[model samples]
Each structure stands twice: as C-alpha cells, then as structure tokens.
Target: MNINDIPNKSFKTVYKGIDEMEVREYLKEIKQHIEELEKEKESLQKIIDEKNENLNNFKSVETSISEAIMVAQKAGEETKRSAEKESERIINQARLHSETMINDAMMKSQHIAMQTEEIKKQSKVFRARYKKLIEAQLDLLSTNDWEELLEYDKDINVEAQSKVDNIVNNDDNVNN
Candidate 1:
C-alpha cells in the first residue's frame, strides 16, 4: 500500500497479540520518516526545475549568438563585393579619362605642328621678297644715273630733284 495507507492498516485482536500501543508508536515513526523524505524530494525537484530553466536560457543565448555571427558574416561578404565593384568602376573611369586626355594632347600637338609649318613657310616667303628688294636697290645704285646726277652743275635743278623724288616713290610703292 501507499504511505498514506500505513496509518489506516488494521490488525485483528487475538490472545497474546502484539501490543496496540507499540504498533501505533512504530507507525507514527514511519509516517514521520515518509514526510521528511517527501520534503527532501520536493526540494530536489525545485533544484532540478531551476537547473532546467538555466539550461534553456543558455541554449537560447547560444542560438542568438549563432544568428548574429551569420548576419555579420553575410554583411562582411556583401561589403567586400561592393568594394570590389566600386574599385573596378573607378579604374575603368580613370582609364577612360586618361585616354581622353592623351587624345586631346595629340590633337593639340598636331595643331601646334601645323602652325609651326605655316610660320616656316611665311618666313621663307618673307626672306625671298626681302632678297629681291635688296637686289633691285643694288641694281639702281650701280646705274650711271646716280653718277650723272653727281656730275650735274652745283645749282641743283628743281625739275631733276622732283623727277628723282618721283622715281624713289615709285620704287618704294613697287617694293611694298
């Protein structure tokens, strides 16, 4: 029977049977022992319940940490990919910019070269014209006309001076 039935157990009275008072006393002791054991069991159960709750808490923390780590890893990978793309884009942009700069520089250099060639041609034309003008002046100086003018009478002829001025002016106009 269960511990609760211990006190209610009955025994038939007979000649020289066991003492009732002694039996009652022994039953009382047994009941007290059972009560103490139940109290101890209850205390142990409470400790077990607390330990289970703590274990569950630890498990939940572990799960949360794991999730956080996963999220962090994903974020790191995404950031790395984005950075690589950005760097590649920057490099491409720089390449295009450099190419454009080089092309512009080449075009400018070609224009400058053409300008220099034109200047050289103009300089050659100026030199040739200057040479012809100088030759004409030398030919005029070597003519006998100047000697005739020098031999003329000391009293200068106004008409002859006017003719000389007209000839000089005509030469200047032709040279220009």
Candidate 2:
C-alpha cells in the first residue's frame, strides 16, 4: 500500500494490542486530504496553462500590430516621396515651357526691331528721292521759258487790235 494509506505505528503497544480501526480511519482521512490537494494542484496548473497561452496570444497580436504599423509608415513615406518627385517634375516642366516662351518672345522682338530698322531706312531713301523730284520740278518752273511764252501771247493780242483800228478807219472814209 502507499505511505498515506498506512497509519503511523512508531510507538510500541502497551498491554493491549494496537487498535487498527482508529489508525485506519485516520489514515483514510489523510489519504482523502492528499487526494483533495492533488485535485486542487491540477486545477491550479490548468488555470496557469490557460493564462500562459493567453499571454502568448497577446504577444503575437502585439507583434503583428507593430509590423502592420511599420508597413503603413513605409507606404506613407513612399507616397510622400513619389508626390514630391512628381511635383518637382511638374515644376521643371513648367520652367522649361516658360523659358521656351520667353526665348521665343525675345527672338520675335529682335526680328521686329530689325524689320523696323529696315523700314526706317527704306522710308529715308524714299523721302530723299521725293524731295529731289520736287526740287527738279520747281527748278523747271522757275526757268525763263514760261516768261517767254507770256510775252509771245501779249504780242499777238496787240497785232489783232491794230488790224481792227485800220478796218474802222477805212469804213469811216467810205461813209464820208
């Protein structure tokens, strides 16, 4: 039998034989106590195991959450970088377009200025030629040719008046 099933018979018997019934009863009660303790131990061990499992699950969930946060942060950083790059590209393209427009405007301005200069030179030459033509006409009109023509017309009128006077005189003599 197990040690708990037996009674403690350490002392010697005194005259009558030792009563085993009381000892058996006591040993039985002690065995029952030991069995109760074992059951309590098992119950406590199960609770501890359950609690440990819960703690492990909690740790796993915490790790997963941490990893998720890291991934989200990385994605956010990538988005920010991509946006910055795209903005820079757009700005550079705008700058190039504006520069091209400015360059075109400058070239057109230079062409217009050159055209204006050429027009000015052409106008200057035209004015000089026109002035020279007007001066030549004035010189032609100022010559003695117009005066001689006027004198010739006066002489013709005087000769016609004298012929009329002679005719009138001859008529008067015929009438007398």
Candidate 3:
C-alpha cells in the first residue's frame, strides 16, 4: 500500500521458506526509498508552484504596464486634439501666438512618445530577465543533486534515516 504498510507487511513462512529478517530489511529499504522519493516530489512541486506564481505575477505586471501605456497614449492624443482646437481658435484672433502654441503642443506630443518608448523598453528588459531566471531555476531542478539520495551505499544499516535527516537539514539551511 504505502510506506507504513511496507515494513508492516506480513508474509507467511513455512519451515523452508524465505528469511523473515531479510524480507523486512528489504521492505524497510523500500519504505525509506519511497519516503525519499515523496520528499523530493514535494520539494519539486513547491518549486514549480512558486515559479508558476512568479509567472502569474509577471503577467499581471505586464498587463498593468500595457494598460498604463494605453492610457498614456490616449491622454497624449486627447491633449494634442485639444491643443489643435485651441490653436485654431487663437489663430482666428491672433495668428502670431497660434504658431508658438502649435509648436509647444508638438513638443509635448514628442516628449510623451519618448516616454512611452522608454516604458516599452523597460518592460521588454524585465520580461527577458524574468525568463532567464525561470530557465535557471528549471535547470537547477534538473540537476544531479536530486539523485544523490538514491545512490546510497547498500552496505550501511542505519544510513537511511541519517541521509533523510541530512537532506532535510540541507533543505532547511538553503531555505534560511
């Protein structure tokens, strides 16, 4: 069934059957091996969940940035339109001031365009950096460190619990 059931497993023995102690030791090893595998599975799942959360956060930020850029663009367009209308009205009254006002409005529009470009550039860089970070984490997850627990020496008697403890300690140290 599970790890607990492995060690507690009972096999009927006749006078010429297998040794009970040897079978139990094997079952114990199997149980410990399953436990180690489960721990590794849980650890990997947590890492994956964390990475997924980070990805979700990144998407949210990207959406917010996009929305902000749209708002900025809309505002810029509206300002440009309003300035053109005001310039038209001023030109009907005084042609001299209308030219200066139109030039100022054009400069404002250009400045907004420059700022939008900078924001887009920053968003691209952030996305690239986040992608690299996720790739590095995936690479770390695929490393040989996970298999070290399965490579235990069979000659040792009480090494299973100690190895599990060491792995837990190492994980704790890393988390801290």
Candidate 4:
C-alpha cells in the first residue's frame, strides 16, 4: 500500500474506542526485533575483531617459531630440532587457518558494502524516474488543450443548437 493510505497522526484519534495497547505492544515487538538485530551485528563485529587479532598472533608465533628452528639447526641438537620442526609446522597451519578466516571476513564485509551501494543506486534511479513521471503529468495537465477542452463545452452546445435550427429550416423549405 502507498504511504498516503495510512492516516495522518491527527486522524488516528478516530479509533479511540479500539484498545491502543495492542498497537503499543506491536510497536514494542518491532523495537525488540531491531534491538536483537543490532546485537547480532555487534556480535559479528566482535567475531571479526577476534579473528583479526588471532591472525596477527598466529603470524607472530610463526615468525618466532621459524627463528627458533634456525637456532636449533645451528646448534645441531637432533631432539631440539625435531621439536622445533613440529612447533613450526603447527604454527604454520594455525597461521594458514587464521588467514583464511580473515579473508572470509573481508569478503563478507566487501559483499555487504557492494550490496548497500547497489541498493542506494537503485533508490536514486527510482527517485529520478518518479520525479520525471510526476513532471510529465504536470506538463500534460498544464497544456492549453486541456484548458480549451474545459472552455469548449458551452460553445459546443450553442453550435449544436444552431446546426439543428439550420437543419429544421432546410426541411421546412423542402416541404414548401
């Protein structure tokens, strides 16, 4: 339904007999839903932040582990070498997973941004088209032909009577 179909605030008092409490309750429900969505958005933001922090931590750990491995190899300790290699491998895998999570988060953010932009563009196009249509309608209504048509009705009736009189006169002459 169009916006106009909804009554203005001043006219809404006509339904005073109806329990406005229900309307209030429904509005409260909508507000609650909006709040819930906002909370969900906040939670998603926290998840993204945590993922980014974890990714950074994993990268640091990977660097430190690589350096430790180099030191162990230089010292030529087989046991230390095996432990360092295992730690490096684990750190590398964690870093890879964290990077994937960060990439996914970035992709989701970009997708949302693109969708929002597209919606804004569509709204702008709709507004332009609506304005053009309204202006065209106004132009049509403002034309001289519409005014002339309004003025022509009276003149048309007079002209019709005159034609009838002439037809009658011609019939009388033919009868004579």
Candidate 5:
C-alpha cells in the first residue's frame, strides 16, 4: 500500500484486549514508514530545486534574447537614419550641381546673344561699305569718258600702222 495509507490503519485486539508487544511492533513500523516518507520528501525537494534552476535559466535566456532584439532594432534605426542623411546630402549636391549648370548655360546663352548682336552690327557696316564701293564703281562705269577712250584708241591705231609701214619699207630694201 501507499505510504499515505498509514493514517487509516486499524489494528485487531487480542482476547485480553490489545497486545502490548504488537502495539510496540506497530509503532516501530510506523516510525520506519515516517523515515521513508522523510527521505522521499527530501528527494522530491531536490527535484523541485533542479526544476527551479532550469526555469531560471530559461528566464535568463529569454532576457538575453529580448536584449539582443532591442539592440538589433536600435542598430537598424541608426542605419536608417544614416542612409536618410546620406540621401539628403546626395540630393542637395545634385540640386546644387544642376543649378550651377543652369547658371552656366544662362551665361553662355547671354554671351551668344551679345555676340550675335555684334555680328549683325558688323554685317550692317560691311553692307554699307560694300554698297558705297559698288555705287562708286557704277558711277565710274556710267561716266562720259568714252570720248576720251575713243581718242586714245585712235592714237594706238596710228602707231601700229606706222610700224607696219616701216616693216614694209625694210622688206623692199632687202629685196633690192
């Protein structure tokens, strides 16, 4: 029977009533049973202690895991912040560069416009000068100098005839 069944025990009495020796023997057995229960209680307490230790270890591991998760989250937030700052810096740099390029292009456009205006002014001056030169040429060609030119041509014709006469006279002499 179970050790817990000791409390419900009932002993049968002898004819003269309960035997003193049997009572003593029953007391001895009950004492041994109490000792055995004490040993079992100690053993159960040791098992309980071991289980408590394991539970504490589990709690510690859980705490460590929680701390690790927190650290990782903090690191991720820090990385995100760094990336955002870097992106902002890059966007600002690109904006500045684009503005510089636009300004440079505007300056070049203004310079080109000024140069074009100067070229137009130069073209007008050249056309004016060329027009005056052509008009002077046209005026000279339309002049009344043709009479003087005809007289000069007559003098050239007379000189050429005289040379021809001299050549004929020399040939006649040579033949004689």
Candidate 6:
C-alpha cells in the first residue's frame, strides 16, 4: 500500500478495537494535538507579522535612498549650470575688455597721427621763416648804401621791439 493509505488502515484498526476508555483517551490526545497546532499557527502568524514589518522598513529605506539620489542629481545639475554661467560671464567680460582695449588703441593712434601732422606743419612754417630771415640778412650784407642799410636796420629793430612788447602784454592779460 502507498504511504497515504497507511493512515486509513491505522484509523480502521483503532476504530474496530475501540473500547470506551481507549476511545476517550484517543479523543483527549487528539484534542491536545489540535490545541498545540493552533498555538503553533498563532506563533507562525506572529513571525509573519515581524517579517512584514522588516520588509516595510526596508521599503522605507529604499524610498529615502531614491529621494536622496534625486536631490543630489538636481544639485549637480544646478552646479553645472552655475559653472556654465560663470564661464559665460568670464568670456563676455574678456570680450568687453578686448573691445575696450581696441577702441582705446585706435583713439591713441589717431591722436598720435594728428600730433604728427601738426608738428610737420609747424616745422614747414619754421623752415620758411628761417629761409626768409637768411635771404633778408644776405641782401642787407650785399647792399652798398650804408646809411640806407642803417635806417633799414633801425626800422627792423623797432618792429622787433614792438612784437616783443605785444607778446609780453598778451601774456600778462592771459595770466590775469
């Protein structure tokens, strides 16, 4: 017979020899076994509840870890954006400085060119004046009329004195 059929054969044997005292004793033993099984079931239920509580705690920790990761990612993104903005600001500042330097250099070059042109004009005027003075002195030296030359020299000296006086007076007026 199969192992499953053994319990049925034992049950039949027990029932056929069943005296009242023996039956009472068997019933008492079965009742005690049933009570013990009920207690074991209660203990198993308690163990299951504890395991469920531990699982819930693990789920809470997992959720917290996930939230922390999300926060860290957001902060990293913000930091990257801030760094990019700072880099852009630095580039813009450099561009602005470059433009300013170029403009200043251009202005300085224009000023220098203007000054050079003015100096050239002044030099030309001084050279023409010097040539005229030299020609006048040479003509006076080659002249045969000494009295006329002396008179001319006196007139030139008077004109020179007048120009000096005018320059002095203008300087005084400007200072005042």
Which order, best to worst by lDDT? 1, 3, 5, 2, 6, 4
Lowest summed lDDT window (length 10), candidate 5: 2-11
Q: Which scores higher on TM-score, 3 or 6?
A: 6
Error (Å) of candidate 3 at residue 141 is 99
lDDT for 99 in candidate 1 is: 100
What are the TM-scores, per candidate, against the unseen true structure?
0.65, 0.58, 0.47, 0.34, 0.65, 0.55
Expressed as tens digits, the lDDT of each residue in 124-171 for candidate 4 is: 999999999999999999899887887798689889999999999999
Candidate order by TM-score, decreasing, is: 1, 5, 2, 6, 3, 4
RMSD of 6: 14.9
Clashing pairs in 6: none
Residue 74 error for model 6, in Å? 1.7
Q: What is the lDDT of residue 68 in candidate 1?
A: 96
Q: Cα lDDT of all candidates, in order?
A: 0.92, 0.89, 0.90, 0.84, 0.90, 0.86
lDDT of 6 by residue, 34-150 (tens): 778878989999999999999999999999999999999999999999999999999999999999999999999999999999999999999999999999998988878877888
Best by lDDT: 1
lDDT of 3 by residue, 66-171 (tens): 9999999999999999999998988777866787799999999999999999999999999999999999999988988656645644425357778889999999
Each prediction's RMSD to truth: 10.3, 6.7, 66.0, 55.4, 6.2, 14.9
Q: Model 3 has how many clashing residue pairs?
A: 0
- Report residue 19 deviation for candidate 2 (angstroms): 9.4
Clashes of 2: 0
Give RMSD (Å) of candidate 2 vs. truth: 6.7
Which regions in candidate 3 have their CA more than 4 angstroms from the true location? Answer: 14-16, 95-176
lDDT of 2: 0.89
For model 2, the stretches where C-alpha displacement exceeds 4 angstroms are: 1-43, 144-176
